[model samples]
Target: MNPNGRRGVELMCTGATSNSSWMKQLTSASRQGRHGRVLHLFFTSLRPGDRGAADTHPAAIPTALRACARLGDASSGRLIHGLVLTRFPSLASDAVAATALLDMYAKCGLVASARRVFDEMPRHDDLVAWNALLAGYARHGLPERALTLAIKMRGQGLRPDLVTWNAVVSGFALAGDDQMAGDLVRAMQDDGFQPDVVTWTSLVSGSVLNFHYDRARALFRRMVAAGNRVLPSSATIASILPAFANVTDVKRGKEVHAYAVVTGVEQNLTVSSALVDMYAKCGLVLKAHRLFDKMAERSSVTWNSMIFGLANYGHCQEAIGLFDRMLCDGARPDHLTFTAVLTACSYCGMVELGEGLYRAMKEEHGIEPRLEHYACMVHLLGRAGKVAEAYDFIRAMPLEPDCFVWGALLGACRSHGNVKLAELAASRLRTVEPANAANCLLFSDALASAGRQDDVVKMKRLAKRRRIKKLDGCSWLESP
Candidate 1:
């Protein structure tokens, strides 16, 4: 035996059959301190072939089970499960321990093992087991499986409690299945389950994913009217706030901010970040800046959100200044952070700043420039009428440039009336996106603008041959 294993055996040999409470102390220490070694000692202290081990209290088994779960030691959990079987089979029958076992298996990513344990349980009446399985499915991105299991659970005459319903709703919302999630909410209401804050939050998050901002707002209103004591979490606020960004109705976004204040979720990091993003997206960069300044604590995500918000609203200088401040404040830039900063440079035609940041990202921060960063560079150079330089930059990139890069170049060529370069960029774009009506239309427009009527006619003929139709114009009206 290994020396450490031998030492454990030697310790066990001395106290193999002792009821001196040392075993109990060791077991308690393992549970309290989450020390796996103490548990090893406690288990080894049990006499070999001790038939009376099963007489241990059920409470002791949960403590051990919890220790195994916390440590995420599946082998220890399995061994403990066997010990429970041999010493106290009744512990396995205990609902709480069974749930613990299910949870342990789930946490270890052994959902199938958890399901087997669930199937073997004598009583399926345990709602905790059902919830554990639902949570397991949800955590693992098996939303459809979770939904199917939930339906089966209901079919078996088991009414889903609030936790079970929440799990299914959250699973669907996260999976981007807003319609199915909404249907489930309607079903829950039909089944006489009143919508709680969790339910409303789930619906709002799902609606936001589907870009149904109005529905999200309406649900928020209903949540307030219901007066359920269940408060909205920061996650709920974050999810819905971004939906208001693209909406022209700044008034609705302000209403959301007011609700956040009233509900006391405004101070939460997620909610605060969302408020900053919403204000910037709605063309209220000053409000966003004010909120950012007032935050007592800021995470990297908080800084990134403000940077992106400022960059998005054409406050490029302010964004660059904030980026510098973020670095000064010891916040490291993530990929999205760099993307925002690069976009800011692009918006302000600050090619030098963009190029410097790009180099710093690769050399200093060890972050490789992504396609978006390159695209931003292309847009920056193109906007400055350096079409040839932009084309060379795209050609020399480490990775293949996508249609966006070519499109940016083509737009630049059109602006500078470079017919030859426009044709070259459009030709590359056509191969990548054969059915792109916008590319054809833009190429035709460029040709016409350059007085190349013959080329324009030929391009129109190609569009007709490809059965590409020109886009129709439409406008949208947002509800106040």
Candidate 2:
């Protein structure tokens, strides 16, 4: 059994079957982000009848709902909600309990359900419910709806507080509306609320999402200049580090690292993961590995980042080893983890291992293959000169193969001088990416290499007729 499961069993052994004891464990697990443990404790404490441990300890229901929210287990959340209806019907009228239900639905991406709960709540004066619903809409890509709800909240005479303003600002910022986010910040300031770390972090995170790396850096600098007034939090550090990572700006990344250290957020999982990613992207893989070794905790993101860095820099063997270690550490491998490991297998020409991992990913881990995973498999087989086998794999794919899949096949065919398969792969690629001149250009080169002058001419003519010209590639160098 896993360590957590063993610990939970021990807790159950010592708790003497008391509902309060189970509730304490449930609340503790939920607070610690151990949602799975929270669920386990909650369900184990339940009896068959309506008046079970859950009814005796009504507070545990909201805590369980919160765990369901964190896990995105909407089915389980609904079960808990139904339990409340049947066993603890009075909880539906308690604002705190009802608000927890509303928040859970919102966090689970069930915005309509959240809105329904908000509308049905007995009290309209509860600003917590309003904020919960507002945050739900704001977070779920309906910034306009969030703003509308905020206005409606004001109409109900519940004056918008700092949290209310931050929710709206975050919504706009996250949606990439920098101008609107700025306007909201000024508006919040006018209303006697200054932009806090959360406010600045939202703007920084939005800038990063919108590919405004320079703007994100500038905003981070401004936030730092705020000095003791409003310090950068772990979220702030994590959000801004990606900008440096994407730009390969190691100097700036190092400065941020020093700041994280000074702020004592260097040990934070998210910040540490971002730091590893930044160092790796900046061509400091060894340094990244060192940092990874020093980390006391490693999330899936941390492992994936390190593995990708190793795979990308020709450390395929080490990358695969790290993946095994990740499994040993009991970190559940996600889609990205498979992608990184498969990439390593592809890079090292470990075709058999790659195939085994691919099957295991589906059969053992239950992670259905995504397009990128299929692309990686194709690349793996194609790189090993298994051109026909790669094509067969593509045919067996549940998804319609994208340009990357066909492109990998074509590139492999070119490498192995398989002109016939190259032509077929190029044709499919062109069909998928009709305006991509690179497809025609690649096929033209393949034909030229095979002494098919007429076919090469035809490919060039097709590109010219379609007005499809490959854009010139460029590179950026960070100034010293």
Candidate 3:
């Protein structure tokens, strides 16, 4: 028979007896670079009367399943699972096929189904199965379950390799269980397993998440001292560099920068962005600007970091200017970029510029203004004694006004002594955030300012009844 005729005949054998022939055809199709066709042919062969008894081969179903997963075709994956159940339910007992199924389910975000397959496996005793389930749990944000599963795997006499340990450690780190992640690292060491780059990177990420810059630094130091020969990636440097931004110790931040240079990651986009942020937050905007300018390729995140850093340091004009430069450079501004720019405009009391930018954000850039943006606008209007305009803006917001938005109007009301506006703002504020002590205090202060002593007394009584303790105001100074 010709190849086409043979393929047609192959498609007609759907029963279990055709297992061997199906396996051979699958191999031939794969070798010929027709993976998708191979999957289609396999499933086509399994349809109703076409399935041959030779299709009972243990490896045929898994081969098809793997192909479906590789294609990322969820429908194909489900069809293969159905084929497995229909033609050869015994194939589910195959450890390799079960592992493949677990992987397919996990990749498709069907973790619950993956877990079911894992639980139903008669031979759930393998490390591969355990690792697959643990990885699924981690990927789906069930790190706690992943951790528990790891312990159970160990208890059940499965010797987890470095890959397994890395998964568990990374899972704990992502879940914000830094201490448990650290303990796992220590446990791995105790078990005579030398931690790899993945182990260190996971720990570093955990430190970054938990704001433990010092611990991250210490881990990096240890990695260097050991001379284990694994270099930190740009992503790793990016992850830890931001923590050093707010750090009082510029000396330490400089050390990390030096390391980035030594590791040849200084030109890395993420690392460069982080370095800019760190230097800016350390009151070294000039240095930040110098680094930013030196970058050959800058991402939008890089621009945002520099713009936000400038805005945060009270350099509103420069921040706005940088924002314009970002646009000139054709870097698209995300929501965060607009928030920074709007905040800068508010702080500088550039109401006209702020309003223009706000309108342009929606009209020109298609960016929807969020509550924070509205709050900044309200504050700007209130500062200029445009209380009525501010109130109107709140009412006209695309979404329901949040407590912060209402509080902005309340603050403006207090500043202008607009008793009616103040009462309206307060009533809306109370509805949105009833237990907010700041809102309550603002309302009471507004009542007092409006000469409503009886109302003020009543508000104070309500405040006392709610046991709302005033927050202490504090400030700090950093030596540059």
For each candidate, the alpha-carbon lDDT, in order, equals 0.78, 0.87, 0.79
After superposition, candidate 2 runs with Cα above 4 Å error: 1-19, 47-51
What tens digits encode model 2's per-residue C-alpha lDDT throughout 300-359?
Answer: 999999999999999999999999999998999999999999999999999999999999
lDDT of the structure predicted as candidate 3: 0.79
- Candidate 3 residue 108 Cα shift, in angstroms, is 8.8
Candidate 1 lDDT at 46 equals 65
Clashes of each: 3, 0, 22
The residue-level lDDT of candidate 3 at 184 comes to 87
Per-candidate TM-score against the hidden true structure:
0.71, 0.94, 0.67
Residue 6 displacement (Å), model 2:
36
Return the clash pairs for model 1, or none: 53-87, 54-87, 54-88
Q: What are the clashing pairs of model 2? A: none
- Please write out the lDDT profile of model 3 over residues 347-418, one tens digit for every residue: 788999989998899999998888788888998898788999998887788888888888989998887889
Error of 1 at 173 (Å): 3.7
Tens-digit lDDT track of model 1 for 181-224: 78877877787786676777877887787787777778777666
Ranking by lDDT: 2, 3, 1
Indicate the TM-score of model 1.
0.71
